[model samples]
Target: MASSKSVLHIITELGRGGAEHMLYKLLSAMDGNLANHHVLSLGSGGPYAEKIRALGIPVHELGMRMGRPNPMLLLRLRGLVRKLNPDLVHGWMYHGILAARLAAQGRPVVAGIRHSIYKLSSEKFATRLVIRAVASLSPSLAALTYNAHLSLDQHRNIGFSSKKACVIPNGFDPDRLRPDPKVGARLRAELGVQPDVFVVLHAARFHPMKDHKGLLQAIARIKDRNMVFLLAGTQVDSGNPALSGIQDDRVYLLGERDDIADLMTAADCLVNSSWSEAFPNVLGEAMACGLPAIATDVGESAAVLGGTGLVVPPRDPEALAKALVQMKDMPQEQRIDLGKRARQRVIETFSLSKVASDYLASIKMFWMPTAGDGPKDVQEKEFLVHVRNRGVYQLAGRSGWGRADFAHHDRCGAPSWPR
Candidate 1:
C-alpha cells in the first residue's frame, strides 16, 4: 500500500545557496498528512542541517568525495533507500538527481533542474556523459522557473519530456526571513555608512557566473558620493581580482553572512549581476523584506522581480551603473512604494506553504501507486541497528541479530512495520 506520506530528498550539499534554501523551505512547510521527509546530503552538512534536525527530520551525511562520482556512493545510497523505504525519492541538482535515479531503479523518482540548460556547457567529455546519464534516468523533472523549463526543452542532451517536466517557482518562509531594524542599524553604523547614504546590496556566491566584476565596475561609475555598495557572498578563492585596488569608502565586502535580512532591509536597493540564474532566491528574499531590486535581465530574474524593480542587460557595467544612479536619485516615497509592491508580489506568488502543497498535489496526481504497483511490506531487519550500550550484562554473549531472527524466536511479535 502507498502511504502517500513518505519522501526522501537527496542533495549535493546543505550549503547556503538558492536551491538548498528552497529545499529547506519546502521541507519545512510539507503537509503532515501528505508527506514525512528525510534528507541525504552527499557532502558534509552545514548550518542548515541543524535547523532541519530541529524540525525532527532525519538528515544523513554521506561525506562522499567531491568533483568525481564514485560508484560506491550509489551502492551506499541504494542501501539507505532500502532501509528507509520511502514512497518517493526526490533529487535536487545534477549529481543528486543522477545518484537518486540510479539508486531508485524500482522506485519512483523526481528530479529538480534548478538552472537553464543554456547555461550548462562543458568542454570535458566526462561532464557531458554525466549530463546525458541524468537526462536518461530521471523519470520526472521539475524546473524552478518558466525560462528554465524552456531552456530544458531546447537542449537536445537533456531529454526531459514536456509531459514529465513542470515549472515550480522557488518560495520563501516570510516568518523566518523577517527583517530586524536594530541589526540593520548596527550593521550600517559598524560599516561607517551615513544614515543618508544610498546603499546597493548584492548577495550571491562569489563565482565567475555571478559577474561580480561587472558589479564592481558599475559601482566605480556611480559618481554619487552618498552611494555605497555592500557585496555579501562567499569568496571562492583568495579574493576576486575585479575587486582589487578598488577600495573606496563607498564599497564594502561583507563576505558570507548569517543576517541577510538585516542587510537587505538596510539597503536602498538590491542588485543582481549574474550572467545566468534559474530563479534568483536573493532577489525574491530581498523583495519579501521590502527592498526594490536592480537585476540584469538574465534567467528568470526579470520574471521574479516583475515590474517592481529595474532590469538591465548582463555584462554591461555602464548600463548597470546608470540604473543604480537612477534608483539613487528616485524619490524616497516612490522607492518605499516600489518596495511595498515587491513584498506584495512575493506574498501573492511565492509562499512556502503554496509550494509544498503544489509538490504534494503533483505527487498524488502522477506518482501515486496503482493496484498492481502497491508498496510491499518493508522488512524490519533491513532497518535494525544494534544498541551496544546496554546498562546491564550482555545476553548470550551475542551482540545482535536481524529482526527476522528475533521474529522467528517470537522475541518481537509478528514483526509488523509501518507501511
Candidate 2:
C-alpha cells in the first residue's frame, strides 16, 4: 500500500461548540493509517486542545484573540503551512476557511461550514465580512462540506458554489448516548422531580441565536405546574440576568454539565428554540438517548427529527407552547414509540463511524489527482465528472457553465474540468 498522506486541519478556535466537538470526535474515529493529521487553532486552544493532544495528534495554536482580526497571523500561518507542506488543508469554519485558502498556497483545500446562513443582516459586522469573503473564495475551494442542507442552500443563494459541496449531518455515539430508564429515574429522583411531572429539556449555550428568551416566554405561557423545563448549557444558570424574566418555579437552570446524555434520558423530550443553526447536535443526542424532541424549524432540525417529534416556527412562542402541550398530551405508548424511532433514525444514518468514513472519502476525493493523471478507476473518473459538471456560478443571475464546457474530453474520455 502507498504511504499515508499529510493533512492539516485549521479551525477558528478550539472553544466549546458543536462544530468543535464534532471535529474532536471525527479525528478520534478516523483511521490514522489513512493520513497523517495535524491541527492548527487560529485562536487560543480551549478545552479541546488538550483532549485532541491526548489522542496523540499534534495541536498548534496561533494565540490570536477572538473578535480581533490580525493580518500578521496569516503570514505566520503561511510560514507554518510552508514548513508542514501538507498534501491537503481542511478548514473548519468561516475564519478558518478564508485562512486555509490564503495559507495553503495553491494546495487543495476542503472547506467545512458548520453554521447556517439564514440572513446576512442577522450576523455581526465581522462575521458578515468574513461570510462575503468566503463566498467570493468558494469557487476556488476543491470541495466544501456543510453540516446541514439548509446551510448549503442559503450559501448557494449568496454566490457560494453547490457543485462540489455536500451535507454530512453530525453523528452520534449510540453506545454512550443510549437510554437508561434506571439512570433516568435516579436522576429525576435526585432532582426532586416527581414521576408524574413532564420534563422538557432545552440544551444549548445562552446565545442570542439560541433565542432563550423565546423559549422562556413559551414555557411561561404553559400554566401546567406539573410540566418542568430544564435549561442546561454554558452560562445558563440561575444568576444569568438574561434569565431573570422567568417566573416559573418549575424551571431548573443547570449551568453546564459533562453528562448531557443523562439529562436527556431524564427528560421526556428535547426542545430547541434557536433562530439559527446548521445542525443542532443536542437534538441528535437527545434522540440517541431515546427521547423525542420539539425543535424550531431552523436549519435541519425538522429534517433531523424526521417526524419522530414536533417542529415549530422559529421565534414563535405560541407555536412552541402549543407543541409542548401536544407532546405532553401524547399517550405514554405513543411517546415511547416515537423515541424508539428517533434512536433508530440516528443509528441507521448518523452513526459516528459512518460520518467519519464520509469525511475521509470526501478528503481523498479532492486530494487524489484526476482526469489527465495516470490510469484511473471508474469511481474516480465518475467523481471528477460529477465535480466538473456540478461547478455552478449563480451570482448576478449567471446560470452555470453550458453543456459546451463538458462537450470536450481528454484521453480518459471524461469531460475536461471547467477553467
Candidate 3:
C-alpha cells in the first residue's frame, strides 16, 4: 500500500454540529498508519477537541467568532498553513473554505460544501455574506466537494461549476457502531425506561432548523403513553429554557452524549425533524446501529433511507406523528427485520472505512501528480520525467487526469509511476 500523505483539515468550529461530527468520523475512519491528519478550527475548541488530541491529531484554534469578520484571522491562518505546509488543505463548511482558499498559497485547496440552502432566512446575515464570498472564490479551489447531491446542484444552479464539484458521501463505521442488545437493555434500565416502552430517538442540537418544536408538537399529538422520546445532543437537556417548557413526563432529555451508538441501539426508532439538512448524520448513525429511522424528505435523506423506514415532508407535525405511530405499531419481528436491513444497507454502501478510502482517493492526487498525465495546465508541475526513455514523458491529462508536466528529467530510470 502507498504511504499516507499529510493533510491539514480546517473547519469553522470543532463543535458538535453535523459537519463537525462528520469530520470527526472521517478522521477516525481514516486514522492509522495510512493517515496523517491535523486540524485547525477558526473558532474556539469544542467537545471534539479532546478526542482529536487523543487521536494524536494536533488542533489549532484561531479564536474567530461568528457574526463578525476579523481581518487578523486570515493572517493567523495563513501563518499556520505556511508553517505546517501539509500536502493539501481541506476546508470544512463555508467560513473554513474561504480561509483555506486565502491560506492555500499555491497548494491545492479542497473546499467541502456540506449543506444545502433551503432558504436565505434561516442563515445569519454575516454567515450568508460569507457564503456569497465563498461562492465567488470557490472556483479557485482544486476541487469543491459536496456530501449531498442536492447541495451540489443548489450551488451549481446559482453559478458554481458542476465540473469542479466532487461528491463523497458521508461514511459510517459499523465496527464502532453495531447493534448490541445487552448494551441496549442496560441503557434502558439505567434510564428507567420500561422494556415494553417504545423509545424514539432525536439526536441533534437544539437549533431552529432542527425543528425541535415541530417534533415536540408531533409527539404531543400522539396519545400513546408507552411512547418515550429520547432527545440527545447539545442543549437538549432540562436546563435549556426552550426544552424546560416541555412538561411531558414521557420525554427524556439527554443533553450531550458520547455514546450515541449505545442510545441508538436502545431506541426502537430514530426520528429526524430537521427543516433542512445535508445528509442527515443522525439517521446514518442510527442505521449503522441497526435502528430504523423516520426522516423528513430533505437533502438526501429520503434516498438514504432506501425503503427501510418512513419519510415525511418537513414541518408537518401531523405527518411526522403519523409516521411515529406507524413505526411504533409495527410488528415486533417486522421492526427487528427492518432494523437488520437498515444495518445491512449502511454496511454495504456507507461503511466509514470505504468512505474514508474514497475521500482519500479523490483528494490524494491533488498534491502528488502521477505519471502519464497528458498536458499540464498547472505550470509549477512542469518538471520532466524519464520512464526508461519513453520519448520525453510528462504527466498526461488523458481521460480527464489533469496533471501531466514533463520537459526535463532530473532523475532518470525512476519508477514509471510517481511515488
On lDDT, the leading prediction is 2
User: If scored against the real structure, what TM-score would every candidate get?
Assistant: 0.82, 0.88, 0.87
Say which prediction, candidate 1 or candidate 2, comes out ahead on TM-score. 2
Tens digits of per-residue lDDT for model 3 on 1-419?
63457788999998787788788888877745665788999998788877788777899999988877788888888898888888789989988988888888887787888899977556888888888888788667767778765777688766564434555677888888899999999999999999999999999888888999999999999999998999998899989999898889999989989888899989999999998997888888899888999999998887777788899999999999999999999898988898898888888777888778767666655655656663233312322111122221121221111122333323321222231
Best by TM-score: 2
Comparing 1 with 2 on lDDT, the higher-scoring candidate is 2
Q: Model 1: runs farther than 4 Å from truth? A: 1-4, 122-126, 139-151, 154-158, 178-180, 236-244, 366-419
- Per-prediction RMSD in angstroms? 15.1, 6.5, 8.9
Candidate 3's C-alpha runs over 4 A off are: 1-4, 31-35, 370-419
Model 3: weakest 10-residue lDDT segment is 393-402
Q: For model 2, where is the 10-residue window of minimal lDDT?
A: 392-401
Candidate with the larger lDDT of 1 and 3 = 3
Better of 2 and 3 by lDDT: 2
What do the candidate models score in CA lDDT, each in turn? 0.69, 0.82, 0.79
